[model samples]
Every structure is written in C-alpha cells, then in structure tokens.
Target: MTKLNCPFCYNTIRRRSELHFMCRGRPTGARPACQPELDQVRSNLTGFKEATLPTFEAVSENLMLPFTKAHCPKCGGETTTRACSHCHTRLPMEFGLDASPMVAMVGARGTGKTVYLTVLSNELQKPKIRSEFAATVRPIGEGQDGFGAQDQWVRESIHQVYEDRKLFSTTAQAVDGRKAPIVLEWRGRHNRRFVLRKFRTNYLSFYDTAGEDLTADDVTFKLHYLRAADYLILLLDPFQLPEVQRLLRLPPAALLHVREGKPPIDVLARVTEALKQGDHWNGRHITVPVAVAFAKMDAFNQHLPETHPLRARRRTLGGYDEKTGRIIHEEMKSLLHEWGGDEIDAHLSGHYRSYQYFAVSALGAEPDYENYLVNPRGVRPDRVEEPLLWLMHKGGLVPRAAS
Candidate 1:
C-alpha cells in the first residue's frame, strides 16, 4: 500500500499504518472502507506510471478516482489527497471530465467587489450568456463543494452587508453568519467547431476573492491560484477617479485617506505590486487580459455628459445609456486613451499587454439597502455584461464564430 498524506490538515500516514483517518479535522472511524466503485480506482492506477498518467477526460469517462499522494501533517493520515484516500470523501472523477479555464477576481478594498460578484451570479443565469457559456453560478468549497474550503468571512461579508441590508466593515458586526466564495462554472463553445473545428476548449471556473485579501502584504497562498489563471478581472471603482483627480490637482496635499472610499489607492498600489510579483513568480507577463472595470456606473452616469467638454470624447470614455442600452462615455475612453492610449485597445505598442476599459454597474440602480435597490422605473443595466464578455472572448471561452 502506498503511503499518503492528508490534503486537508496536511497530515501524513501510511495506508498500512494503524491510524484512523480524520479529514480537515473530522475523525473518520477506521478510514471507512473504500466502496467497491472506488476500489476499482485503486486497481486501475495500481501499476500505472506517473509519466503515462490518464487524462482528466479518461478519469471522467471511466468514473475513476482523482487522487494523488499527499501528506496530512495533522492526523498522520497518509493517502489523503484532494480526495480522501480513506473514508467516503472519495473523488467523483466524473466531475473531472472537463477541466475549467480558471479566472480570479482581485482588486482593492471597498471596490464594490462583493456587490459586483453578487450581481454577476444573478447575471450569469440569464439566457444569452448562460446559453453561450453553458455554465451556472454556484457556491463552492468546504461546506459547499468539499474543496479546499471557502473563506467564511468573505461569504458573510457580502450577505450581511449587501444582501441582508446590514452594515459591514472591518469593524461592523457580521449579520449573515459567514460568507462563502462564489464558484461558478460553465461550458464554452467547442474550439474544434470554431478553431480547428475539432473539439471544445475547456470549462470555466470563475473565483471571486475578497477585497481585504487582495490588499494584504503577504499573498503567498492566494498568489498560487493566480499563477495559472487564464484571465483576471480587476474591478476599478469610479469613485477612486475623484480622489486621484484631487491628488493630481494638489500634488503636495498628501494622499488623504478618504472615508467610505472605493478602491483605496494604497490598496491599489499594493495589489499592483502583488501582480508584478505574480508575474515574476510565474515567469509569464501576468498580463492576463485585465478589465479595469468602472463598477457602479449609475453613480457616475449623471456626470457623464458634463464630465468633459468633448461629447465624442466623453463617449469614448465609457458610460451606460438608458436609451441606447449600453453606452460608453467619451470621457472614460479619454481616460483610458490617456492611460494606455489608443482607444482602450487590447494592448499598447510597447508597454502593457492585454487590457481593456469598461464601465459597468452591478445593480443598475444603486442598492439602497434601506430601499432594496429599488428601481421604480424598472431595472436596467448600464453595460453590465461588457467586461465579462470581453474576458470570455480573451479567454477563448466564447468563440467568435465568424472568426
């Protein structure tokens, strides 16, 4: 029997060892005998060499196990892996049939990330994007998907503060027990049909992170997940534009910590450093097609027409139009043109890589917790789906059939 390590508590024990297996902390009596179905998994991989390992598709088709040797440092339980080597938490290799393209959400504090994620969950359920993507939004991890465990603080933070109409902050008491990370999956158009007209690319896994985490000094563990990420959606709050403008006007005034501000500059600076670090670590230009998303455009919509003198320039800036459905204010385009230049193109000539400018509003109408995000005139999104679509296209998750 091969010795294995517990993935949960990082405990290591051998199959022949006389230790009861406990996962993550839960003690399983006698390492519950492997079911007949799972026993076959062990049999198949018995003599298999690591070099000729079966593909994810093969395991999914055969209903084989998705387990690997890992050490469980806590319980001395060997054979512990992402799937339990012992006990009933065996892998459902079936779920492994499709390997999802991974995407991570990272941004600064108070960027309305939670609200944006909450709304993205609801948006993905819509017909057009849902059909095109063949995926659904869901909560995964720990109590949900039995994965690497979800962060409870993030889950409750959104629910209590935004969903439950309760105030939330680094100081405020949580109203909704604990927050869970929202994990959504969906199938993209087959690439063979679009590319070589042979096979579908891969499934997509969208993971949302809390703003607080992105700003932390040490993102060692968090940075790991982002290494192989296909795309990164960075939320940039328009509220920060004012602060940046204010500072630019008074270069010597010192950067003041604005109250209830969205996307603190200090946090943004740290996030930037982390991204650079990730690029260094991965040895790949962490240029994972970023969407410097201007979230909650409704607040900035009123200032659109009057934002800048040039009307066409304002449209290029980006905005949402109630009449035309999705509108890009010229001012936003101007800003992006100023930052990255060239009408917010995919990439600039020399500096920067894949990037785009977008304006989006999560709730359309401001989420008046006191008023339940009331839109008496009926709900209308101001270019809410552009950023996601842009990302999907860049990720090859959605095919440009015409191409």
Candidate 2:
C-alpha cells in the first residue's frame, strides 16, 4: 500500500495501518490544536479574525476487520468519509489507492507563484495540450461536480489572468485555517513501447501560500507542508535579485514596488532544513527533483541577445524535449552566474541530488498597472508548462526518449 500525503495538511497517511474518520454532519465551532496561535498570526498579517474551524476526531480501526462503517465518537453521527490521520482533513476517494504527486511551490515574497499556478492550470486543461499527453484534468471530491471555495478561487484567478488580462493580487500572507487545498485529478494513458497500454490516474495537489509565510522564521509549524512534497518548484524572481534589479535599470517608481524579503538561497536553506527535520534524508542530499526556475523572463529579455537559448521557443503542446530543456538549463546557469546568484546555484547543487534550471515567462509582456490590476498585452506564456512537464517526465508519468 502506498503512503499517501494529505493535499490539505501535507500529512502522510499510512494507508494500511491508519484510517481516520470525519463527522458527516460537518460539525463546526470546535477549534483545532493550533487555532489560537494561528489566529494571532493571521490577525497580525491580514488584520482580520479567522472564522471558526471544524473539528475532526481521529478514529482507530483495523482495515482487516469486517466493519463496513464508522461513527463519530463525539457527535455519535455516522461517519462516511476518511480524513488525514495527522491533520484530520478529508481525503479524496483515491487518496491511498492511486499515485498522487504533491507539487509544492516555494519562493520569496512577490515571486509570481500565484500567476504561475494559474497559467500552469490553464495550460494543462487546454484540449490540445491534454490531447498530446492523453490526459484530462478535473477536480476531485468536493470540487468534482462543482467549484468548491478553493476551486472557485482558482477558477477566478485563472479567468482574471487569461480572459480579463489582469494580474492576480499578491497572495495574502495570512493563513486561513479553513482553507482547503486545490486538488486536481489527472487521468491519462501511459504510452509504453510505442503503444498506449496502461491507464494511469494521478492526484495533483497544489499548495499556494503567501511568500511571507514561507519565509517566516518564527513560524515553522505552519510550513510543514514543504516536507511532504514529491517535487519542489523554487521560483526565483529575477526582479527580486539585487544584481538583476540594478542591471534592469528600472525607473525609481518600479523599484519602490519591489519588496525584497529573504533571498532565494535563504528560502532554499529553510526548505532543506525543514526536510531534514522530517523523514527526508538525514545528513544526505534530498532526492526529490527540484526545478529551480527563473520566473518573469520577459523582463530580462532586453539583457539577452537575440540568439540566446532562452529566446528559443518550443511547441507547448508537444512532449517535453530534453535536448531543448538541457540547452535552456545551461543558458540559465550561465545567466545565474552573471546575475551574481552563484550562492543560490551552489546551495542547490550541494543539497539536491537532482536539480534543473529553467526560465519561464507566464506573461509574455510586462503588465500595465491600473489601480490594483495589471493589464498585460495578451496571455502568451513562454515555457510556463515546461517545468511541470519536466517533473512529469522525471517521475516516469510520461515515457522518456532513449538517451
């Protein structure tokens, strides 16, 4: 049996042994273990009180037993759904039975993670792209038939970016205890030996938190989700790099908007430390594939020559091209050195067993700021889907061509 990670709380559930049940009545008004501390933090960050959260009780049951149902101990109501043994969040129907890839997005504040996620979801759901991979992207559980609150947020974020051509507001730093993860189910045919034979379904869980929450040194408990990720996407904002900011020669007004938090290297260090505290390697390098991407590539194009590898575009709907990806990786490495990010490069190399450099531009052009909205020319994403496709290829979800 596979040990599944909870998409909501980032808890690992050992399917064979531990099974947790939640009240079907959806009991409310009870507080979680860390509610008081979390509430204080949320209030300080967003200046608002979090709503009361539901309480979930753990149920110990033997799967080998013949019991067909469970009942909540407190409310005595019939419990029909399973939850994460650790966080008590509801689990999807196929949570333990199928392969689920937990992809975590990490970066300093103002790194465009929200935009990347919005575009990545849009690209994955495109019919042509889905046809190329023989995959269909759908919501799971509460989001299966209709949009849950989190699903609605994702849909609205995507619509605002793609249809309305407006930039999403920076994700708030406060943590909402009631927030559920946006879980997507990917069903596709696995092509093997030039034939589509096995049908595979994977649950893709995305956790998008405010960048400040990730870099908070005083609060590490809330960021435990980083350790449970199967893959990590470290988005390095070019604009955040001090050297790049100087080189870009932006106007003073643009510089004023740039809020520099912890450096990318520092953020990566904290993530690696979190992994060490968990079951992730002890005194060993992390084996999970880490895709360190340079986001907002369009802003840096002026510095690169016309023949730069980053300027080369590939078909977004086709299978991943390792040759092209490698070229971009090398080019990005060189650019990182030029941008005085050698420490970031060195830290990744020393801590991760498998790492790749990528450059992606979610918006093809810079946005025109109008009040709180940023209107771009059009949604012409450059290589926004490559990092995800690369992760899928590395995980063996898609067949890799012979080297």
Candidate 3:
C-alpha cells in the first residue's frame, strides 16, 4: 500500500489497503533534523515496490489514485495543487537554472503583471538594454517551441505593438505543454557575470495563480516556492485604497463583501499563511526586498485621502518616476512596519541582510483602442528599468558604474 503522510500536518494519510495507491512512506516524528523540518519526509520512492503498483508510466497519471486527495488542514477542503494553467502540471525543475538570482512576483489580479512581464521579456531582447545590463535572455527549462505556444496566446489576446515583431509568446497550453522558463544572465560592465542559478537563470520568475485558487483553504502548493525566491515584487492597485482602509479598520461595512473586487490584505494573508505552512522553506530570512508597487498610480493619485500626506509627494500619479520612487518605498516600509510586516522584515533581515525598494510603470501611456483594433501601437513603457536595476544591484550582479 502507498502510505504517504501529509507533509504539512505530518498525519499518516489515513488510507485503507483497498486504496489504489502504494505506500510512499511515513514521518520519523522525532525532531526535524533540518531547518525545514517538514521536507525531511522522504519523497524519493524509486526502488520501493508495491503489491499493486499502477502501471501508468507518467507521473501525472500516478497522482490520480483513490486515496491521493490531499486535505487542507485549515478548512479541510480538498487541497488544490498549484500548476501552470497552460501546462496543467508543476513546472519541471529542469527548467530552472542553478545559479540564477531568483526573483518572484506577487500581486492581485489585473494589476498589469502579465502585461509587464510580456513587455519586460520583449525589452530584454533589445541590444541597448541587454548590453547595458550585460544579460542574455533565453528559456531555461522549456525549449523555444514549448514557450512559443504560450507567447502565441499572449500575443493573440492583447493587440500587438510590432506588426512583424510577433510580440511575446509562451508554451503553457499543452496537456503536457512545456512552460517556457525564461532565464536572464547578468554580465556586469566590469566583465564580472552573475548567473543566479538557484531557480536556474538570473531572471525573475513570474507566478500567476487564479484568485480563487489562492483563496482556497487547502492549497497544496504552499511553501514550495517561498524558498526559491531571493526577492519579491508585489504589485498593488492604487484604485483600491478605500478598500485597504476598510480592511485595516475591520469595519462592519467592509464585511459586507464588495462584489466587484477583493482586498489586498486577503491575498497578503493567504501568501503569508502559505509561507508559514511550508515544510521546505529554509526560513533563512528572505534577503529579498518586497516592492508594493501601486500599479495604475496614474489613474488614482489625485484620489488620495487628505489624512494621507504621502499623496502630496506624487509626481504624476499614473506615471513612473525615480523621485516618487523613493517616497513610495519609504511609505510602503512604514506601512509594513505598522502592519506587522516588520516582524517578517526582521526575520528576513537575519537572512538576506540587504534589500531596497522602487516603484515602476510598465506602460507609459494608456492604449488607444479607438478602432477596437488589437496591438494598439505607441507603447511608451516608463521606468520599466527600475525593478531590474534594483534586483541586479542587490544580487551583486552589477558594480557601481564609474562617474
């Protein structure tokens, strides 16, 4: 019988012999001999034999056993595993580079993260940016053809910028479709190069999960990627300021649950909960800095509350600016310090020991869909350079340029 224990709860997955699975193994239960105590459970069952092992050759087929339903300890909901919507599977570890600086993105839906990624990847292809940054861009794990499929869908969904440029494409739509893993290699001007290989490339890993999946109680993907990140770029929508205030106060009116949208705090809570539940996260203190980018700042800066003096520092609400960047960073840190993120920061400080902040706008101007034509041209991406610059500096991938 396949008897595998729940890594999070450490409870033997109560299963009967009639269950269709073979025994994976049980926890030792003495004391976690390692920092990530939960990961101590054995995952490699290479030679273990079973009386009735299913003959399916693929790992995906093997996961569908009768007693394999993972339960969320919090709400007891069937734990949902995180996977690429395009590929319907956990991204292959081979797609990751061993020495690349690992950066991760976190944000609410429609905060322009996907679009930003499309633009950033496309921009990296440019010689000015690529050469200036001393970085080479390529798909690490997923091959060109595999990633090509995903990009095709993305290019087709939104209008294109270059009629012949083909825009950006990804390979996530196959049943076993490959997810194109993008790797960025930063070669500093000083001829020193850093190939951040942990997640397998000097590039950032963009994580996009459906909002519904993130909110569920039994999230199986929790803690898996937390340790993979060296920095986190968290996007925010400035238009949701009112909702943020309500969440902070826990007012009864806010409890009514606005139908049109969800609050950031809820998402933040889910993320933190996932981090706390992970069995493998090294807990080395996330040396990564978190940028709470108030995306679409252009659309909502004038609406800031009078009590929030930070509004006066705005330099064109929706546009990106370096001066405004410094202000938002300070304000965000202050807000986090007040909201108990300081404790999290203190924990990370012990590990990463160094970090910084920035604000950015991927699109400089709004799309003119006057004709309903896709690929509306004239994409003026502003300060799209800031975040990468920050990551490179912090990762020690670059040296201070001589004056």
Pairs with backbone N, CA or C atoms under 3 Å apart (clashes), candidate 2: none
Q: Top model by TM-score, which number?
A: 2
Q: Candidate 2, 324: how far from true, in Å? A: 1.6
Global Cα lDDT for candidate 1 = 0.44
Ordered from best to worst lDDT, the candidate numbers read: 2, 1, 3
Tens digits of per-residue lDDT, candidate 1, 191-233, equal 4433443333233344455555554467523344454455667
Residue 322 CA error for candidate 2 (Å)?
Answer: 1.9
Once fitted onto the true fold, the runs of candidate 2 whose alpha carbons sit more than 4 angstroms away are 16-82, 86-88, 142-147, 174-179, 190-198, 252-260, 313-318, 369-376, 401-403
User: Per-residue CA lDDT of candidate 2, range 187-236, in tens?
Assistant: 88755455454666788887776777757665544466667788888898
Model 3 C-alpha lDDT per residue in residues 235-264, reported as the tens digit of each score = 654434554444344334222323344666
CA deviation > 4 Å runs, candidate 1: 1-97, 132-180, 193-203, 219-222, 243-257, 260-265, 279-285, 305-331, 335-351, 369-380, 401-403
What is the lDDT of every predicted structure here?
0.44, 0.69, 0.41
Q: In model 1, what lDDT does residue 32 have?
A: 38
